[model samples]
Target chain A: MSTDLSRVADPGSIKLYTTEPDHHDPITLRSIGFWLYMMSDIMIFAGLFAAHGVYGDAYGTSKITAAQVIDPISALFPTLFLFSSVLFFGLAGVALKNNDRKEVLRWMTAAFVVGLVFVLQEIWEFVKLAQEGAVPQASAFLSDFWTIVWAHGLHVIVGLIWMAVVLIQVLRDGFTEAVVGRFLNLRIFWFFQAVVWVFVYTFVYLMGVS
Target chain B: MAHHQSSPIDHPEIQSASTLQYVSAFVLGLALMIVSCIITLGGGLSQSSTLTWIGILALIAVVGQLYLLFKLDLSKTMIWHTVSAVLTIPLVFISIVVTMWMFQYLEMRVMVGGS
Candidate 1:
């Protein structure tokens, strides 16, 4: 049996038909890989939350202040602030896409300041809790509490660093195509912080108060 | 992997951002957070009911964020990430539910005076 190979080419040109799919270029691969990494991060959060659900109330024979140490009012600021940062970071993404260099930088600076305020408030919260004698080593629940919240805090810190790098690069290089991927990834990272905080507020803080 | 000739600006995800979406998500998210605080501190609901309401509100907030901020949707290119993110739900539910249940039974049987 003979197979008739069909090809479309210019005169005196040679081209072969490819049966296999084209490989993903670096850009596509970068996004897919980053998304997969984020999925794994989600799993880590799930495990931590499970630990919290399991041992969150294991303070036996010890004075459990429970929710009294955490002020609900204080918690609201961080949520609003971080969510606002997430919103501003998103606006930065829009600016980046629109090729507006200065606007992207401005949005990023605003996001950074708002995000810093959130981190500082969180630090203040931890300090107040420590002063109230509800340190990480207070009990099993506090251990889980500090671990999860700090894990999130660590992410926020890293996000701040990444945001700074992206901003600096954009400042030096302008909003070229080369920087879009990095900026987009930072947007995703910032959004993840807000998402995780929702879980923290729901499971840990709200439940504690309840 | 298939390279279409569309410009990068024409990509759905890149151009999906909007001030309306952002502000709405922010306001709605802020409201949900405040509502949670109020339910907690206002002493309107019982303990279990408060937990339930807060969880429900959180789900609403997360769904809103996923839509407005992340711009996740069921489009051809976006569905991959969206499905991957949503796939973790079963894992989270199972992990939290099973672990909490296991420990709850264990404590009920073998211990006393759980906080």
Candidate 2:
């Protein structure tokens, strides 16, 4: 194809084009971007999960297995806490729909509190496991267990921090487009964490014992 | 931007939020969790069967959360989000399922005393 010299000369008329669909709405863009990030995050967790599946039952020379180290019954409490946290966060979304700033803060605080409990409960469970000779160094199974669970725990901690930041922004600046966008993105984030937790609970704790 | 200026709450992303759906989703998840927990703890089924049950429950919970919490719907505002998510479904299966299959074979062929 011959070069369009005249088009190049008129730089102002040289309109750049892209193959991707035009996404001009900031709100739509924000959500799609966040969902893409969540997909990447899911891949990270997927790798951890696969690693866990491989090493989960690999007790090696040790007599301890995943069932011995993990207790689904004890995990039930933290699982409930995490689920309730998601529920409260969803309620916060409802509050945002009504533009009830105070109610939004209230529901979000509830979400944060329950989320904190979930994290604390997880740490406590890990501590107890470690005390019972189930440290990551003990066996391949324990190593995988700790790695996956702790990975999820770290995400929860980050989610909590993000939740706190959004709450503060709403309190200080009111609900601007940016703040609301952040809130909506965080909604995806918080829900994504809960979904990850479901798998972790199932494959790690429940199926560990199964 | 000035012409579009309005309450952020009026955004369709916010307007579609539903408390009832959220509550029901949570309850559904809890029910699945409870049932799986009982079956797992009771040891009524074989290991493979128990694993299968747990897998089914987890799948249901994930779907419920995607539908209710994330609003993966066909509405005007949510359609793109839904499409992006649906596209990722294959990757999700490939990542977890394919990895498990590969590792299972490696365990049998390479690991000593593997079944």
Model 1 agreement with the true structure over A14-34: per-residue lDDT tens digits: 546667987644445566678
Locate the minimum summed-lDDT window of 10 residues in model 2 chain A. A19-28
lDDT of 1 by residue, B1-115 (tens): 2465244444455677788888888888889888888888889888888888899999999999888887788886678888988887788788878988987898789876545
Shift of residue B79 alpha carbon in model 2, Å: 2.1
The TM-score that candidate 1 achieves is 0.89
Q: Would candidate 1 be rated incorrect, acceptable, medium or high by CAPRI criteria?
A: medium
Q: Could you tell me the lDDT of residue B11 within candidate 1?
A: 47
lDDT of 2 by residue, A44-78 (tens): 88888878877877887777787787788888888
Tell me how far the alpha carbon of residue A170 in candidate 1 is from the true structure, in angstroms, after superposition. 0.9
Considering every candidate listed, which one attains the maximal TM-score? Answer: 2
Candidate 2 chain B TM?
Answer: 0.86
